[model samples]
Target: MDIATIDRRRLIGWGALLPLAALAGCAAGPGGYSLDEGVRRLLTLSTQRAFGRLLQPGGFYEDQLARISPPDAIGAGGPGRLNAIFGAFLRSEAVRRRVSLALNDVAGRAAQRAAPYVLESIRGMFTADAVRTLRGGPQAATDLLHQRIGGHVVEVMVPELAGLLRSDLLSALSAAAAEQTGIDYLELGRTVAEQAADGIFRVIGREEAAIRADPAATRDPVLIALLRR
Candidate 1:
């Protein structure tokens, strides 16, 4: 058989097997979890993995996949833009790296704070409205996650981030910022927390999309089965 024919046969086989897997998982569970429960568990697992990856050393600051930098709050044609004006040292590679490290540190701290609450928050997201949207497409669950729990994550995250900001390489960032704005550490900490929270959510959403697109990634046999349905 040609490549296309072989691929087609494999697809057919998976389609046939997936529902059986789902049924087996759902039926054999301790209390017989609902399909929504299965989906929620899968999403929680995916989100945990996705955010956890970002907390590793170099995961955010050095990994090309997750690295982030300070926002360009400065706009075009500003004094700093054309004249290479004051505080230009803040843009130095060293300063940028320090800032990046600080941001990543804040994210890691925030993520740790958010961890215990993550599953519960996600479980709560499957409201009637959200369940209806889940059938919309791959992004529905993630969208609901953001809409429902994003703020809570940020709220939980910011204070932890703020606390850590002073200790986790905060001095380096503070020094960098001192040159520019005397470093409103709390305000800066909040911004960092918000950005980090946003980044983690984005990562989790991407992971959810991946699992939805490829049912096998759900890993739970029941979840795979439900996806087939």
Candidate 2:
């Protein structure tokens, strides 16, 4: 789809996710459930929820917590001096807004795809480490998740970022910004992608931490039954 089209439908197919926090608490009160089933469902639901928040309209850019900006210029004539010069030439407000929107859109799209892939990764990784991770530090599950999915995230996201850069609006902006600012626009595209991937990982890590901390998760009826007291 064209940049304009994608920008308009910013959240795409996934938005307004079920209030999972409330649901988890409710389900934890009474139910028979297995740890394996609980883990898989929790992993899938939590990841989808994370991505849903991330991809929502103004989700990334609107929130100070998730906002991302273009990487600072680096190299000869780098941030020391060239930064201001580059900024001056690439100063079209419209183009700037469009670029920001487009980058977020690409990131959101990649995140949508990532939700399922991450669930699969979690199933494989969490199964082996479930016991230790549950008893370990608050961030243990998150850390384990990062280790399992870090490489795959970059693999899945960067190329999509590059691919999105080929769109007309982004390509035009990149060329214009490059010519006007004398910065390597291509590298900037990759930087945006890398940052996007980083943002996705960062938020998912937070989700893992939240799940780890939730008392209800520990008290989850299904999970408790699986552990047999």
Candidate 3:
């Protein structure tokens, strides 16, 4: 057979076997444990743990990696003379600290409200490539998940985060800042949501990497089997 014909035959063979391979991967372990189940469990555990940490008071504020800082425009010059004055005002150390605290607080509260939406996204987005994902790099699962659903998570989070920003304890400060700097709070919400999602995924990726490095630490047979090198 010519090269094209040979390639076509190989494609046909793999296509025919794909379903059986998927079924076997899904029902391979003891008690009918499946790659799907293992992946879901891992994702659930990681998400829950990440959210749990974020839900704590000052969680985002206390963690350097997770903390939300003031928007750059607040420090950098904006469109006009009024913006420059407001930027100067906000650049003061004390005022900037308060703004940073407020942002982090809003992020933490938003995270509390966002957990369900995130979990729902995960449930909806996971595909049938669990085996390859598990066998890939430490962040393979997290990378895949974020690739598929990060934008969705951020989209869902923006409005909720905006609402929280409006109602948070620092609402007055946020309002003044928004008004003076000509920064739209809704845009601020989007920024916070994006950073919040980044922190969440960072935690989840760490958990996944740890589990892959030491599958026995999970103490879950399904994960151990599937993630074991």
For residues 49-121, write the lDDT of model 2, one tens digit per residue. 5666776666667655456574546223566555665555347677667666766766666565565566557
Ranking by TM-score: 3, 1, 2
lDDT of 3 by residue, 106-208 (tens): 8876665566766655554445677787678888888887877787777777887777776662463555655555555577789899998888788778777
Which ranges of candidate 3 are over 4 A from the true structure? 1-27, 74-78, 167-178
Query: Candidate 1's residue-wise lDDT over 1-229, tens digit each?
Result: 6433443344334333322222333323324555556556556766666655665555566544445566544223454542353246456898767767777766665665665566556644444542354455776676777777777787887777667766654476544444444344466567776766677767777777777677776566655765553
- Model 1 misplacement above 4 A: 1-32, 62-66, 72-86, 129-131, 168-170, 173-180
Cand. 2 Cα-lDDT? 0.55
Stretches of candidate 2 off by over 4 Å are 1-39, 74-85, 89-99, 126-128, 166-175, 181-186, 215-220, 223-229
Q: What is the lDDT of every predicted structure here?
A: 0.59, 0.55, 0.67
In the predicted model 3, the residue pairs found to clash are: none
Best by lDDT: 3
